[model samples]
Target chain A: MKRRIGAAGLSLFISATLVITGCAQQKILDKMGLSVVIGYDRVDKDRLLGTNVLHQFDPMASESVQIVASTAYTSKGTRDKSNLEMAKKAVSGQLRVTLYSEQLAKEGIINLVDTLARDPTIGARVFLAISKGRAHDILKHRYPEFGNIGTYMYQTISQNIEGESMISPTLHDFMHDYSSVGRDTILPYLEQRGKEGNELVISGAALFQQDRMVGVIPTKEVFYVKLLRDRFQAGSIEISIPREVLGKYMKVSQKKRGNDPIFLVLDTLSSSSTFKLVDKNRPQINTEIKITGRLQEVSEVVDLSKPEIIHKIEKAISQAMMNEGNKVIAKLQKLETDPIGFGEIYRSSVRHSNLTRDKWYEMYRDAKLNLKVEMTLVRTGVIE
Target chain B: MKSIGKPGEHQVFSTFFLFWVIIESQIGMGILQFQRKVVQVAHHDAWISVLITGGVIHVVVWFMIRTLAKYESADLYEIHQHALGKWIGNLLSILYMAYLLLLGTLVLRSYIEVVQTWLFPEIPTWLLSSSVLLLTVYGVLGGIRIIVGVCILSYLFSIALLFFLAYNLPYADWRSLSPVMEANFQELIIGAKQMAFTVVGFEIIYFVYPYLKEKKKAGRYTQMGVLYTTLIYCLVLVLSIAFFSEGQIKKTVWPSLSLFKIVQIPFLERFEYVTVSLWLLVIVPNLLLYLWAATRGMKKVFHWNQRRSVYLSAALVLAICLLLKTNLQIKFLGEWAGQLSLYLVFVYPVILYFIVLIRTRKQRKEVK
Candidate 1:
C-alpha cells in the first residue's frame, strides 16, 4: 500500500516536469522575422545608423525582403528599435552578411564585428564586407533585376571566395586577425553602381591595418594579393601579356588592346606560394610561387602545336605575374598594411622579435616582396 | 577498522570500463574553454604546457592507484578512515565528498550557462539545471553498471564532434605555432598549472579503483584513459592556437565551442547551436561520475542508504546551481573547484599515499 502511494507521487512529479521545460515563448517560424543581412553605418557621435534586411517568410508578402533602418547607441539597441517597426519579432539566427561603410571601417569596425562574433546565433562564416559609400545605401536600395539584395550580396562574395579570387573576410577571420599579433585583415569592398546606384559591384578589397581600412586594392590587382596570401584550389586569371614574348615562338596578330597585348586566360589554375624570411633585420620576403594551369582561351589566334610557344607563353606569364606582384606589394607598403601576412613571417622566423601590431607595421613599411613566379601551361585548349 | 566497499559479484565491472569513466569525468566543461586560461600564461607556447601537464597527470594517477591498491575493495572514504583514525578519516572523507559535489555543481552551472546563452535564450536556470540534474539522479539510481554504460555511450557519441575542427583548417595559420619553445620554463609550468583545472576529473580513479574486476590491470587501463583525455586536450589546444590568433583566443570564453562556430552542414544552418544542445548528453557522465562518488562517501560516512544520499546530493548540487545565477558566481565556483582540486586531486593523493605507506610499514613492523 505504501509502495503504491510512492509510485503515484513519482508519476505526478514526472508529468509535472514536462510542463516547466516548455515555458519559454515559442518562436514560430512564420511569425518571427529573420534578419538575413545587417548593415551598420556611423551616425553622430554616439549613435549608429543600422539597417536590417528581413527575410520574407510569408507567401503573401509582396516584397522579397523587408528593410529596416534605424539609429541606436548600441548594436542590440538597433535590433530592438528595428523590432519596434517590424510586424514580427526580429531575430539574428539567420544573419549571413554584415556590411560596414568605408567611413565606419576607417574608424575600425571591430566594435560592431565583435558582437557578431559573440552572438552564438550568428555564424562565424558570415561574410563581412566594406561598402564604398554608406552601408545603409547598399542595403536599403532595391534593384530591378534582383529581389533579395542581401542574398545576392552573400552569393556573390561566397562564389568568388569559392572561385579563389578573394581571400575570406569572415567574422572568424576578422576576429582571428584582430586578436592575433603580426597579421592584419582584408575585406571585400562593395559599391552600388550602374544607373541610380542600385546595381551592386565588387570594386576592390579593403586593406586593413589592424581593424581599420587603410587602403583599397582594386579588383584587377586583387589577383596578386590572392596569389601571395592564399593557395588556390582551382582559380582562373586573364593575363594580358605583351605580344613580343609570344611573337618569338609563335605567329601573333593584333586584334585588341592596341599593342596586341594578347589576353591569355588560364583556366583550372592551381598555385602554391612559399614565403621565406631570409633578411629578418630589414624584412625581405622571398616569395616562390608555382602556378599550373591549362590554356583555356587566347584573345589572338595562336598556333598551339609547338612546345616552344607554350614555354614562351609560360615565361611571359611568369614575368607579368612577378611584376604585378611586386607592384601590389609596393602599394601595400605605401598603404602601411601587411595583408599578405609579412608580419606572420617576420614573427615566426625570428625567435624573439617581440613583434606587436605597431612594431610589425614599421617593419612591413620597409619589407620587400621578392617574387619568382613559375607558370606551367599543361594543355593549350582541346587541341595538341 | 572494517574492510570497506567490497561489492557483490554482480557489482564488479571490467577494467575496460575505467577508460570511459576517467575520460567522461575529465572532459566536462573545461574542454570548452581551458585554452583561454593557458594562453594568457604561455602565449603561443600553450600547447607545450598542455602536453607537459598531461605527462605530470599520468604520474599523479599512478600514485593514486598505488594507494587505493593497498586495500582489497575499499574506496577513498574507507581508505581515509583506515589511514587516519575514524573521526579524522570520516572528516577528510566528508571534505572529499564536498569536493565531488562542488565539481558536479560546476559542470551543471557551465552546461546550463551555454544552453541559456546559445540554444535556448529564455530558459530558466532552475528548469534547465533540474532537467539535466535529474538525469544524474536517474543514472545514479540505476547502479554502477548503468553509469558506466552512459559513460561509454557518452564517449562514443562525443568523439565524433572533434572532427568538426577540420572545418577551420583552411583559415588555419600553422605558422602561428611558430616561436613554439619561446616561452621560458617558468612560463610553461605556469601554463601547465592553469591547465590543471581542466584535467581535474581523471582522479575519479580513487573512487573507481575498487569496482574494477581485475585490479592488477587497472593501472594500464586507467593510464590509457588519462592518455586519451590528454591527447584530446592537446589536440584542441594545438588547434585553437593554430586556428585563432594569440590575442583573439584570450577574448573567447570557450575556445573549443568557438572552433565549432564555422562548421558547415548543408541541412543545418548553425552547427554550434546543435552542438550546444547535444552537449547536454556529453556532460551527463560528468554529473553521474561525480555524484556517484559523492553519494558513496555520503553513504559510508553518515551510515545512510545510498539511494537517499543520491537524492540529497542531487538536490544540494541543484540548489548551488540555482544560487549561482550570475556569471561571476559561476566563475568563482569554477575557480574554487579548480584551486581545491589542484591540491586534493593532484597533491593530496600523493600525501595520502605516503601516510598510508608509513602506517602500513609500521603495522608490518609491529606484527613482525
Candidate 2:
C-alpha cells in the first residue's frame, strides 16, 4: 500500500513538472508588426531608402481593413542593409508584393537579388514588379475604393492579366526566367496617374538583360510578347485590319457589312513555342510560334461559321503576330536582351564554354523567328 | 522480464503500416542532404542510381533474413558465432554495435541541429538532445513491441508532414529535370552507391527477427518495409529536383529543409517549424531502434545484462555526439560513415551468406 502511494506520488510529481514545462515553452506569436509590402529605391552612394507598407487586421470590424505608410532611411545604408533593418519588424513572411524603382533595377539587382534569395524570412514566391513612376510615389498613393492601396494595387496588377490588359509575373516565375541562361527577367510595370486622386495603371512589361533593366514594351505588344512566351490565358486580343484586306477576304463569304474597317476580337488563345539550334558552333537559333485562337466577337461580321471568315481571321492573326513579334524582337535586339529565354535554350542545348555575354548578344542579333497562326473559330458566341 | 507477448494472434499489421514502416525509416535524415553526394558523382542521372541501389537492397535484405532465420532464439551475434569462430564473431558483433551507436548519435545530433536552425535557436543543444534521449530511452525501456508501436504512431505524423511539400509545386520548374540521363552509366552506378545510406536501416530486422510473433512472415514484412521506404524517399528526391534546379540543389546545404521553409501557412508563418516539431517523433523512434540494436548486440557478444549494456552504449554515443561542433563536421562524418556502412550493411552480408552456404553443403557431404 505504501509502495503504491509512493509510485502515485512520483507520477504526480513528473506530471506537474511536465505541465510547467509545457506552459513555459508556449510558442508566443510575436506581434512584430507584419509588413505586407516593401518598396526600395536608390538614394545616395552606397545607401538606399526603403518604405514598408504594414497592415493590422481589427478583429472587431466586419471586414478586414489595412494601414499603409512609408518609413524611409531605415538604418542600413545599402539595399541589403535596409532590407535587414526593415525585416526585423516588417515580417517579410507575409510580404506579397516587392516593387523596385526603375533606377534601382537599371543599376543592376544581382546583388540585391542574392540577398533576397539568401534570406530565410523573405518569401521567394512574392510578386516582383517594376514601377514606371517613382516606386515611393506609387506606394504613397491611396485609392478611395480600396482601403489598403498597397495590397489593392498589388492584387489589381496581378489579377488584371486574366480578363484585361497586363502581364502576370510572380516572384517564382521571375526568378526562374532570371536564372535561366537564354531567358531574361520581365515584370509588370505600373505607375501613378493623375495629380489629385491618383490611379495606378498597369503599363507594359519592363524587360531585363541579365539583372539589368534594358527596355520596356507597351500593353499592346505586351499581349503578343506574352503569347510568344506562352503565358496566354483567357484574354481578348484586338486587331485592326485595313478595309481593303477585310473586303478582299470577307467578300467571298455571305452577307457583307456595309462599309467599316473590321475590328476582330480574338479570345481563348493558346500558343506553343518550339526552337531548333541550326548550328552548334556559331549557333544560329530558329524559333517557331504556333497560335491556336477562337474568334470571340467581331465589330462587323456578316457570317460566323464560313470557311472564308475563318481564313480572314487567320490572315489577320498572322499579320498581327508578325507586326507585334517584329516590334518586340527589334526592341529586344536593340537592348541586347532575350526576355523569351532563348538564351536558356542555347545554354542548355549547346555546351560551349567560350560563349560569353558579347557572343550571345551577337548570336541573338542574327536569330530568326518563324510565326505560324492556326486559328480555329470553334464558336462565334451567342450573337452569331 | 515483462512480456507484451506476441502481437495478439489476430493483430496483423495493416498493409498501410507495412508501407509506412518501410518509407518512414527510409526517408529519415537522407532526404535533406543526400542530393549533393549523389549529384557529385551521377550529375543529372542520379535517380537511375537510386533504382540500381534499390535492387541491391532487395538482395541484401533477403540474405539478412536467410542468415537470421538460421537460429530461432538468437540474433546477429549468435549467427556470427555459429558461422565464424566465437572470438572473431564476438569482435564483429562489438563493431556492429559501435556502428549502430554512432549512427544513432549522429542522427540525434543532426536532429538537434535542424531544431536549432529552424525552431528554438536559443535552446541549448544538450537540452534538446537530452530530451530526445530521455523520450527514446523511455520507449526503449518498453522493449521492441512498444518501440514498433511508437514507430506506427509516428507514421501518421509523417503523412501530415508530407502535405508541406505540396506548397513547393507552384515554384517547381519542370525544366530543371531536363537533359535527363546526362550522366554516363559509370556515374549512374556511383550515384547508386551514394544511396547506400538512404536505403539502409532494414538491417535492424536481424535483431528484430526474434521478437516477431510469426517468424515466417518476417521476410515479407522486411521487404514491405524497405519497398515503402524507397517509394517515400524517391518521392522526396523527385520533389527536390522538381522544385530546385540542378545548380541550386548543388548549392543548398539541406535541400529538403529549404523546400519545407518555402511553404507559407495561412495561419502559421513558418510551416517548417511545424514540420520540425513533428520531426522529433520520426527521429526518436529511429534513434531508439538503432540504440536498442546496439545494446542488444553488446549484451549478446559480451555476456552482459541489457541494462548495463544499454547505459554504457548510450553514454558512448552521447559523448561522440557532443564532440562534433559544426554542421559541416557532422556532414563530413556522416559521409564517411555512409561509405563505411556500404561495406558493413551490404558487402559483408552477401559475402557471409555465400560462405555459410558453401560450409553447410560441405558439412552435409562429410556427414554422408
Candidate 3:
C-alpha cells in the first residue's frame, strides 16, 4: 500500500513537472493573422509578387479585412515578408485557395507550389486556380457580395467541383498530375468580369504541360473532358443537338426557332468510362463511355411517350458526344497534353514500357482514340 | 535465483495475448516511412520485397519458438544460461537487454521526431521524451498482463491508424503497379533486407514466452500474428504504390503519412494532424513491451528487482532520446540498430536454436 501511494505520487509529480515545462509553442487565434487566400505572380526570373488576403475578426480594427502584397523570391518568403508588414503574425492554417497568374503558371509554378506541398500546415484540399491575367488583380478586388476573397473563391470552386461542371483543382490533384508521367494538371481559369470588374468568372480550365500552362479550353468543352476522364453522378450537362434529329418530334410552338440546334439538358447523370489499350505497339486507346440520365429539359419538345423517340434521342446524343469527344481529344493532342491519361494507360498496360514524360508526349500526339459512347435515357423528367 | 523469471499467476496472460503482442511490437513508427527506403531500391515492385521478407519471418519465428519450447517456462535468458553456461550467457543476456533498451529508445526518439515535425513543432525533446518514458514506466510496472492489455488497445489503434491510408483510394492510379516484375532479383533482395526493421519485433515472443499461460499454442498463434502483419504490410504497400507515382514516392519522406495529406474530410481539415496525435496509443504499447522485456532481463540475469530496472531502463532510453540532437543522428542510430537487429533478431536465433539442441542432447547423454 505504501509503494502504491509512492508510485502514484511520483506519477503526479512527473506529470506536473513536464506540464509546467511548456515546450511546444502556442499560437493564440487573436495574436495571429490567418491567411485564407494567397495569389502569386511572376515579376522576373528571380522575383515573385504575391498577394495575401488575411481574415480580420478583431472588432477594434478599422478595416473590414487585411490585404498585404509582398514581393519575394519564394512562396514561404512572401508569407514571411507579409508577416513583417502586418500588425499580427501571418499564419496559413486557414489557407483555402491559391491562385496563380497565367504568366506565372506559364513560366512554371512548381518552384512556387513546392513550398505549400512541403509545409504541413497547408491542407491538401486548398483550391488551386489560374487567373486569366495577373492573379493580384483577381485577389485584390473586394466584391460587394463577398466578405473574404479566399473563402469566396474556394466555395465557388468547391461548389462547381461537387456539381460536376468544374475540374478538381485542389493542391492534392495538382501534385498528383504534376508528378504523373501520363497525366497533366488542369486548373480552373478565372477572369474578373463586369463593367467595374466586380464579378469573378470561372470561364474555363487551364491545361498545363508539366507545370506550365499550355492552353485553355472553355467550360463547354470541359464537359467532354470530364466525360472521358472522370466518373460522374448527379451531374448535369446542356447539349446542343441539330434540328435534323429532333425536328420530327418538335413542339409546334418551338418551330419559330428554325435551324437553331435543339438544346437538351440531362440531369442526375451517372456516367462511367473505360480506357483499354487495344494495340500497345503504337499506343492505340479504345475508350468506352456509358451514360445514364433523366432528361430534364429540351428546347424543341419531343414526344416522350414513344420508345422510338428514346432510341432516336440516344443515337443523336451518342453522335453528338462522339463528335465532341473527338474534338476534345484532337485539341488535347494538339496541345500535347494527356489529361485523359492515354499515356498512363500505355505505361500501365505494357511491361517494360519505361515511359518518360517526353517520350509519352510524343506518342500521345499519334495515339489513336477509338471512341464509343452508349447513352441510356432513363427517364424524361417527372412527365414520363 | 533461477535464470528464468517465474512471475506470479496474476501476471500470466492467455495465449491470444501473444497474437496482439507480436503485431503491436512489429508495427510501430517504422510503418510510417519504411516504404520510402524500400521503394528506392525495388522501385515500383517494392511490395514484392515486403512479401518475400514476410515469408522469411515465418521461418525465423519458428526457430525462435522451437528453441524456447524446449524448456518449461524458460525464456531467452534461461536458454542462454543453459546452452552457453554462466559468464558468457550473462554477458549475452546483458547485451540483449541493452539492445531491448535501445529498441525502446529508438521508438521513443522517432515518435518524438514525428511529433516535433508534424504536430507540435515547438515542443522540446526532453519534455516529450520524459513524458513518454514516464508513461511507459508507469504502464510496465503493472507487469506482463498490463502490457498485454495495452497491446490489445494498440491493435485497434493500429487498424485506425493504417485506415487513414484508405482515404487516398479514389485518386489511386493502380497502373503504377503494372510492370511489376521489372525489379531485378538483386534489387528485390536488397529491398527485402531494407524491410528488416519494419517487420521485426516478433522476436519479443522469445522474451514473453514464460508469461504465457498456454505456451503450447504460442507458436500457432504467434505465426497467425506474423501472417496478419504480412497481409497488412502487403495491403499498405500495394495501396501506397498505387496511390503515389514512382517519382513522388521517391521524394516522400513518410509515404504513409503523406498518403493522408490528401484526405479531404468535412470535419477534419488536416487529417494527418489528427493521425499524428492518435499515434500515441500505438507507440505507447511498443515502449511498454520493450521496456518490460528489458526489465525482465535485469531481474533474471542480474537478480535486480523489476521495479528498479524499469526506472533505470526508461531513464537510459529517455537520455538517448534527448541527447540525439538531430534527425540525421537519429537516422544513423536507426541504421545501426537495423543492422544489429538483422544479426540478433534474425540470424542469431536459428544459431541459438542449434546450440540449444546440441547442448540438450549432450546433457541427456551425460546423465545416462
Candidate 4:
C-alpha cells in the first residue's frame, strides 16, 4: 500500500513537470510574426533590400498586416535584422510567396533559392515570381481587397495558373528545372498596373538562361509558350483567318472589317503533346500536339452544320497554331533557353552517352524542330 | 529469476505479431534518408541496389534464424553462452548490449534532429529528448507485450503515410529513371552497402525468436516481414527517383521529408509538420524495442534486475545522444553505428552460423 502511494505521487510529479515544460515552449499565434510574403531587391552588388509582409490575427488591430524592411548581406541575415525591429519574432514557416525584383533576378537568384531549398521548414509550394519594378515596392502596395498582401499575391498567382492564363512554377519546380541537366526554369513576371499603378498584375513569364533572367514573354504570347512547353487545357486562343478562305462559303464583307481578317476564337477543352527524336546527330525533333476545343466565337456566318466547313476551320486553326509554335520555338532557341525540355526528352531517349550540358546546349542552338498540330472540335456554341 | 515467458502466461507472440515487429524495426529513421545515400552511389539504378540488398539481408536473416534454432527456446545471449562458454560469452553479450544501446541512441538523435529542423526550432534538445525518453521509459516498463503492441499500433497508424506519397505521382517524371542499369556492378554493390544500415533492423529476429509461440513458423513470417519491407523501400526509392531528378536527389538531405512537402491537403498547409509529429509513433517503437533488447541482454549477462538494467540502458542512451550535439557528430555517430551493425548483422551472423554448424556435427560424432 505504501509503494502504491509513492508510485502515484511520482506519477503526479512527472505530469506536473510535463505541464510546466509544455507551456514554456508554446508559440502562441499572436506572439509570432507569421511572415506570409517576402520580397527581395538588390540594394547594391553586395547587399539585398528585403521586405516581408507580417501577418497579424488580432481583431482589435487597425491593420492585420505590417510591412517590415531591412538590408543585409544574406536572406537569413535580412530576416534576423528585420526581427530586431518587429514587436513579435519573425517566423517564415507560413511563407506563401517569395518575390524578387527584375534587377535582382537578372543578377542571379540561385543564392536566395538555395536558402529556401535548404530550409526544411519552408514548404515547396510557395510561389516564386519576378516583379517588374522593385519587389519592395510591390509588397508596399495596399491590397485592401485581400486583407493580407501575402495571401492576396498567393491567391492571384494560384488562380491564374489554375485558370490556364499562366504556368505555375513553385520553388520546387524551379529547383527541379534548375538542377536538371537539360532544362531551365521560368517564373511568372508580376508588374504594377492601374491608374495609380497600385494594382498587381501577372504581366507574362520571365525566362532564365541558367539562373539569370534573359527576357520576358508578353502576356499575349504566353499561350504559345504554354502550348510548346506544357500540355494545354481550358485556355482560349483567337486566330485570325484570311477572308479569302471563306469567300465562296460565306459573304466576304462579314469576314472582314475594312481590310482586317476575321478572328475565330476557340476555347481549348483538352490538350496533349508528344515528342519524338527522329535523328541523334542532326538532333531533329518531331513534336505532335493534339488539341480538342469548342468554337466560342466566329465573326462570319459559316455552315456549322456541314462537316467540311468544320474540317476547314480545324485545318486553319492547326496551321495557325503551328506557325505560332514555330515562332516561339525559334525565339527560345535564339535565347538559348530550353524551358520546353526538348533536351531532356532527347537525353531520356538516348542510350548511355557522354551528353554534357554544353553538348546539349550546342545541339539545341542548331537543332531542327518539326511541329504538327491536330485539333478536334469537340463542340460548337449553342448559337451554332 | 523471473520468467519472461512462462508455460501459459500469454507471453509468447503469434506469427502475425512477429511479422509487424520485424517491419516496425526495419522501417524507421533509415527510410527517411536512404534514398539520397543510395542515389549518391548508384544514381538511377538505386532501386535495383535496394532489391539486391533485400536479397542479401534475407540470406543473412536465414543464417541468423538457423543459428538461433540450434538451441530451442534460447536467444542469442543464451546461444553465446552455450557455444562460447561463460566468460567469452559474457564479454560478447556486453558488446552486443553496447551495440543495441548505440542503435537506440542513433535512432533517437536522428529523429530529434529531424523534428528540430522541421517542426520546432525553438524547443531545446534536452526538452525534446527527455520527453521522448520519458515516453520510452513508460513503454519499456510495460515489458515485451507492450512493446509488441506499440509496434503493431505504429505499423497501423503510419502505414497510411505511404499512401500520401501518391501525391508525388503527378509531378513524377518517369524519364528520370530512364536508361536503366546505367550504373555498373561495382557501383550497385556500393549502393547496396550504403543500404546496409536501413535494413539492419530485421536482425532483431535473433533476439525475439525465443519468444515466439510457434518457433517452427517464425522463419516464414520473418521472411514475409522482410519481403514487405523491401517492397516498401523499393516503392519509396522509385518514387523519389521519379519525383526528383538525379542532381536534385543528390542535393536533398531528407528526400522523404522533401517528398512530403508536396502533399497539400485542403485543411493542412504544412504536411511535413504533421508527418514529423506522427512520426514520433514510428520512432518510439524503434527506440523501445532496441533498448528493450539491450536491457534484456544486460540482465542475462550480469544477473541484474531487469527494471534496473532498463534504467541504466535508457540513461546511457540519453547521455550518448546528449553528447553528440553537433550535426557533424550526429552524422559520424550514425555512420559508425551503421558500420557496426553491418558487421554484427551481416558478417558476424555468417561466422556464427558456421560455428553452430561445426559444433552440432562434432556433438553427433561424439554421441556415436
Native interface contacts kept by each candidate, as a fraction: 0.00, 0.00, 0.00, 0.00
Which regions of candidate 4 deviate over 4 angstroms?
A1-384, B1-8
Q: Rate residue A334 of model 2 by lDDT.
A: 78
Q: Write the per-residue lDDT of candidate 4 for residues A287-359, one digit (tens) a residue.
A: 9998877677897767664557777888888887888888888988898888888888889989884677788
The 0-to-1 C-alpha lDDT of every candidate, in the order given, reads 0.85, 0.70, 0.85, 0.85
User: What is the TM-score of chain A, computed separately for every candidate?
Assistant: 0.95, 0.81, 0.94, 0.93
**What would the DockQ be for model 3?**
0.01
Report the lDDT tens digits of candidate 1 across residue range A1-384.
Answer: 999999999988887887777577888888899988899998988899999998996789888999999999988999999999989999988888899989989998888888888889888899899999899988878788999987899999999998888889888998988888877899999988899986898899999988999988888788888888888767889998898776655532343334658888986677888889888888888999998776778877675645566778889999999998898889988998877788888889899889888888777888776989999874453122
lDDT of 3 by residue, A1-384 (tens): 999999999999998988989557888888889988899998888888989988888888765679999999888888898888889999988899899999988888897788899989989998889999899988888788777677778889999999999889889999999999899988999999997899998999999998989999999988888888898776889897788786677667677676888789987677898889999877789999998776778866576646677778888888898999899999999999877778888899999999999999888888898788988875553233
Q: DockQ numbers for every candidate? A: 0.01, 0.01, 0.01, 0.01
Model 3 per-residue lDDT tens digits across residues B73-180:
888988888889989999999999888889889988888878866665446679999988888999999888888999997787658666667688898999998887
lDDT of 2 at B14: 42
Q: Tell me candidate 3's fraction of native contacts, as a decimal between 0 and 1.
A: 0.00
> Alpha-carbon error at B261 in model 1, in Å?
1.1
Residue B53 miss distance in model 1 (angstroms):
1.1
- Model 1: per-residue Cα lDDT at residue A190: 94
Ranking by lDDT: 3, 1, 4, 2
lDDT of 2 by residue, A63-107 (tens): 332333333343223333434544234456677787888998898
Query: Against the hidden reference, what TM-scores do the models get?
Result: 0.51, 0.48, 0.51, 0.50
- The residue pairs found clashing in candidate 4 are none
